[model samples]
Target: MITLLLSSHAQRIWGERIAVAVPPGTLSFLTAEEALAAEGPSAADIAFMTREVTGKSSPSHPTPELRGFDAVVEKSPNLKWLQIHPAGAERPIYRQLRARGVKVTTASGATAVTVAHSTLGAVIAINRRFPLLADAQRRHAWEPRLAERSPRDLAGQCAVIVGMGPIGRNIASLLGMLGMRTIGVRRTAEPVEPCERVVAYEQLHEVLPQADWLILCCPASPVTRGIANAAAFAAMPEGAHLINVARGEIAVEQDVIAVLQSGKLAGAYLDVFEREPLDAASPLWDLPNVLVSPHTASHSLGQNEAIFGIFLDNLARFRAGQALRNDVDNLG
Candidate 1:
């Protein structure tokens, strides 16, 4: 029997689904709540660290209780596999889990459409001057940006998308539907669909001058951390907008603020941040040119079921002794 370990939050909502997926008598459950109890399951072969944290969880912030369960898992000498929700696994907990010989798989592709849709919306809103319009609405003032200061057509404008992962590709495909051009950057420069061409990370600066919009959807790898800094922003065409749906460490917060202040970037939409629940006193909150979301760009009605599906599918594969999908055990 495959002994499964999971969160009480997850098991409560998904207990029936889990039972249906795994054959009767083939699986047993030990909730995280029970695992944390003085007398818990002595050993677990698999862990499903799921959460219902829509607005409460940020990619940078794991649920407090869930994060604490790592110790319980480590002591389970038989644990061989685990599943996580976040697309990126840069968090230290993941590293620690991997080091303990657990095969960590993630729900990376689940958020693609939702994240891309929100990112594209941010682009359109900023282009249409929604922030200024919102402020005007609050003051009951009549102010229209027409003629001289009117927004230009998005067609023919270039976008430099970092990462080229599921999220980046979806954003590129949507941008193509809008008649926009796209350039992708990642480990290799090979061309991907929708994007006219692709460039290696080493060539990022070479393509920045063409960007009307710079979207970050890359992983938080060593090469990606803090890649968007002052020097990088200066290479962009003036008035370029930055939309970061990727990890926050990829963009230096202070440096981003500096460029925004200097008008090097026309605006920015940041979902993930270097810090979760971004400091209330942080200028990002008050910046007229910035749009901040509490890492909720990926939140949607179907997201929970989507992630659960990945887990169930992988659970079937695990039961069959086959390789798992979205496995990042060997990844950095």
Candidate 2:
């Protein structure tokens, strides 16, 4: 019997569906609280984790809790694999499992469509000044067009996407169809279609100054943490737009805010934050040149169902003892 530990209530529902889809796999459901209460380190062959399972209460960055993270790894002595619900996995819990010789995986490709749409929406919302219009429309006021910040077209713009992974590639394709010049940044300079040129990670600095729209789509790994700092923001043209749909920690929050405040960059569209529920007093809430979303770029009514579809497909691979998809071999 393969004992699978499910920590979130929502995950339990998804897991039940996956369990039924898999071949004769047994599951054990427990909340994060209950899982902690159980004594003697409950053993499991596999563990499915939500952000809650890793001690992160917010939708932003993962909480820094080595103890709780270590506790989870310690709880599953016989664990073979640990799967996270979200795409980014630079969390302490993921690292802990890596130290424990367990395999890790993420729902990386699953949320691409939702994330791509949201990121594109952010770009449009900020460029079109939707926030101001939304407030005015709420009051039943139909004001004439506001003065443009800079009459720019998303098409004919030079766009640099910082990752060539599933989500990044999807965004590149979307932008390409809109007649934008696409440049890709990948670990290797592989030939990714829909991109005019592929640059290596080392060439990020070179490409930044040329981008009219800079989109961050890289994975949240150790090497990528805080990769986009003041230098990156400063490298853009004066009125260039910035969009981040990747991990929040990938960019330094203070630097981004400082640049936005100083008008160095025309505007920023962010769906993820270094900290979530963004403090009630966060200046970003009122920043006119920025669009702040509650890390909800990857959420939709059918998200769970879509995730289950991928999970069920992988479960079939597991049953056949074949390689699984989106498997994260290294947590760090």
Q: Highest lDDT: which candidate? A: 1
Error of 2 at 8 (Å): 6.6
Per-residue error for 258 in candidate 1, Å, reads 1.2
**lDDT of every model, 2 decimals:** 0.86, 0.74
In model 1, what are the clashing residue pairs, if there are any? none
Candidate 2 has what TM-score? 0.86
So what's the TM-score on candidate 1? 0.95
Model 1, range 196-259, lDDT digits (tens) per residue?
Answer: 9999999999999999999999999889998999889989998899999898889999999988
State the weakest 10-residue window (summed lDDT) of model 2.
61-70
Q: What does the lDDT read for residue 69 in candidate 1?
A: 72
Residue-level lDDT of model 2, residues 1-332, one tens digit each, is 66666655655566556556655645555444455667777666776665444444564444544245447556778887766677766666667787777777788788888888887777677767677678778889986564654446777888889888888888888877778898999888888988999998788889888888889988876667787889988888887888888878888989888887887877888877787767888777877657887777788887666655666666566656777667777322
- After the best TM-score superposition of candidate 2, give how far the Cα of residue 193 lies from its true spot, in angstroms: 1.7
Q: For model 2, what is the C-alpha lDDT against the true structure?
A: 0.74
Error of 1 at 13 (Å): 1.0
